[model samples]
Target: MKFGKIIAAGVLAASLAMPAASFAADKPVVGLVMKSLANEFFKNMLEGAKAHEAKRGDYKLKAVGMQSETDIETQINAVESFITEKVNAIVIAPADSRALVPPLKRAMEAGITVVNFDVALDEKAKKEAGVELAFVGPDNRAGAKMAGEALAKKLGEGGKVVIIEGNPGADNAAQRKLGFEDAIKDGKLKLLDSRTAHWETEEANSVFANMLTAHPDIQGVMAANDSMAVGVVKAIEAAGKTGKIEVIGFDNIPAVQPLLKEKKMLATVDQFGQQMAANAIDKALGVLAVGAPLKGWVKTDIKLVTSDDVK
Candidate 1:
């Protein structure tokens, strides 16, 4: 009788220990790669992902930042490192859509699920690379259209305007420009000059200031992002035309709020960075934890915020 009782207790102990070991094995590891941590936008994305990880203790999140915005080599190396770590999955907002393809393909071949957000790989390239998942950003084209129409309304459809773009090769910039041009196709506005600002505020300021000198009659300015828009506004003010030429920008960063409140900035498109980050992290966790596949694109809506809506 004593021997039988001891055997039963040992069996129960083993059964309890088995489940604990299995649970530890089941915890998913996620890796996030972004353009750079220096930018406030990417920083917010990292914070949101960390918050999600904290809330759901079943997942582990590791975020890696690239050395620079244009450093595709660094990004590729980071992806390779993630692959060697044998993480369950990787979430990347690639610096250059095409440059990261080879490394991403290697990760996929290794049986690690990959998700691309923010920017995307080209369709053919993505197909060839065999990326398992993609979650694209909002409709940049629509957002640009909103800005163009708003500017046309403010300038009454018959004034010269200048456009400051993000980067020449970036899909987001191209899409935004297409939408803005489409909106103004009725000859309502004349685009005097369009140039790349490379998403740098100082560069945008200098470019716009020079353009103002060359085309002082320019009535409005459309910048691809808030950082450039703020720079353009500064240029306009420096040229002593603050109240003359209207300015509209995208990304609706917090710094632009004060400008909008004072009516210095006409309006901006809000991309909802925090919301996008939260959604991406949730999707990543779902795929890692449950083997669910994220297909198609996730569209986060953009809103136009003007002075009246600044509160």
Candidate 2:
């Protein structure tokens, strides 16, 4: 009887020695898909998420991104892989807003919670796909408006400027153009024309060079993203007009800080990539672990950054 008692006591001690959260293994597995691994913004996002996971150690996180934004089929395959893996939740920054809907809906239908960040899926497409997902990112339209407002102020009333937009098909790019248009609506600044650079520095450079040839008297340029802004800066320098025209961009990418401080670029909007990504991970865990219902959208904050704010 005493031997049996000792054996039972040992079992109890072993159970007590294990972490209460040992059952955490049963916690939901989360999958994160980014637009591209090559983008610095997404790199920061990955780092922030990893830091959050280290601190919380709550659920399993499987984060991966596509090779490039244009690789739509690959992104879809990534989602399918997650579906096969049976992840409980997924947070995605879609490459092409409309193209990603079908696979995303499939994930949702498979009982996986979906949280979208950055670029938004097309509303009509989402409805047609028959799935509703939560969005966690900055208010893209409002953020762009803030940047455009600053650019307009720098250019002053009656200034002539041009816009360098991202991929035309992306919701963020279209929304940013609207925000820029809204800011210039005071009839003070005239938009010579807007062109899509498709989010490439080289394309932005070539496009801006051509725009400069067509509109040499333009006073300023508003680029939808820092990558294109880099190209704009190069085109300006190439045209021997550096510092002669005002340049502003969105996304305070670290690479653009030197130019900002040099006063080559006026300002950029910081949507706080790190915080947005970490928050999205927590939101996913909330829905998966605690049975928390995901809501429509959780818009994060945006701040303006100049060269002085680089550090």
Candidate 3:
């Protein structure tokens, strides 16, 4: 499916069909809280959740998304609202790994089933709050490592590179950064600089353009997500260094296909974001059905994508 083309259509479907409270109150309700509706990854996820609801017709789904990737307050408020609604299950992709823990713990205390997906909540915070939520998502660190290793293979040893990171304190972002650092150590690459773009295209462009200015010798870039990669690629083009620099990113969003085919981007990792929420929802429903609480990580799939794969 061409995800980029379908975002608007999918969002339209989601908006028009948002589960109404007027539906039979006897049915189980699933509240989905996600980050950044502006992101194609989350948009596709929301679309998948909507389709899953339609296919099952057994549960009612109520989804909420943030205004931006780093909108922690909105996510907390969404959780509180869901708790107030007393939804049977709450499937969440947290904005801040730590800050969301308290509210989620409160949800659990209120007897609501909670499942964490996408970005995980901090383990320390969870332990502190006594929240025993199971995580259902991909191994973000491993996925990032796959992309980084691919870049390392292309650049070989001692390659000059910079990293454009996602939002600070986000578990996935931190894991991805560590994975990139792992590749740097294994590949013996010289790291020039690393900075956060908060997962915004424009911010990445500006940050990377400045990084390029400071370090014109940078041979490559590793963006934590495809959204930031779009900006990095743009900055490379604006600086007339498109072909001269190799770039790798995570999240194989549809927008990056042309960049990959054209060799503007080296590679990206696909974590099957569309089905992520549905999978988590299934897990949540299973617990509610059998009265068994889920514990530990329920790992999903991840794959590296390049020009060859796209073609």
TM-score, structure 2 vs. true: 0.87
For TM-score, candidate 1 versus 3, the one ahead is 3
> At residue 39, what lDDT does model 1 achieve?
58
Candidate order by decreasing TM-score = 3, 2, 1
**What tens-digit string does per-residue lDDT give for candidate 3 at 1-311?**
22221111100011112233423446789999998989888898999999989987889999999999888899999999998998887888888889988888777777777777778788898779764556656777888888989989999999999999998978999999999999999989999999999998889999999999999999999999999999999999999987999999998888899999999999999877787788777767666665666556656678889999987
Model 2 global lDDT (CA atoms, 0 to 1): 0.74
Candidate 2 C-alpha lDDT tens digits along 197-236 = 8777888999999999999997889899888899999999
After superposition on all CA atoms, what RMSD does each candidate show versus the true structure? 11.2, 10.9, 6.2
In candidate 1, stretches whose alpha carbon ends up further than 4 angstroms from where it belongs are 1-24, 128-133
Q: lDDT score, residue 130, model 3?
A: 63
Candidate 1 local lDDT, 1-311, one digit each (tens): 11110000000001011123433587767778877565566776677678767876777888888655666777788889998998766777777766777787777677566767666566666567554445446788888889888888888767788889876655677778887786677538998999988777788999999898899899988898888898898988888887888899887777789999988888888876644544555555555445545456656567888998888
- Model 1 clash count equals 0
lDDT of each: 0.71, 0.74, 0.82
Worst ten-residue run, lDDT, model 1?
Answer: 4-13
**TM-score list, all predictions:** 0.85, 0.87, 0.91
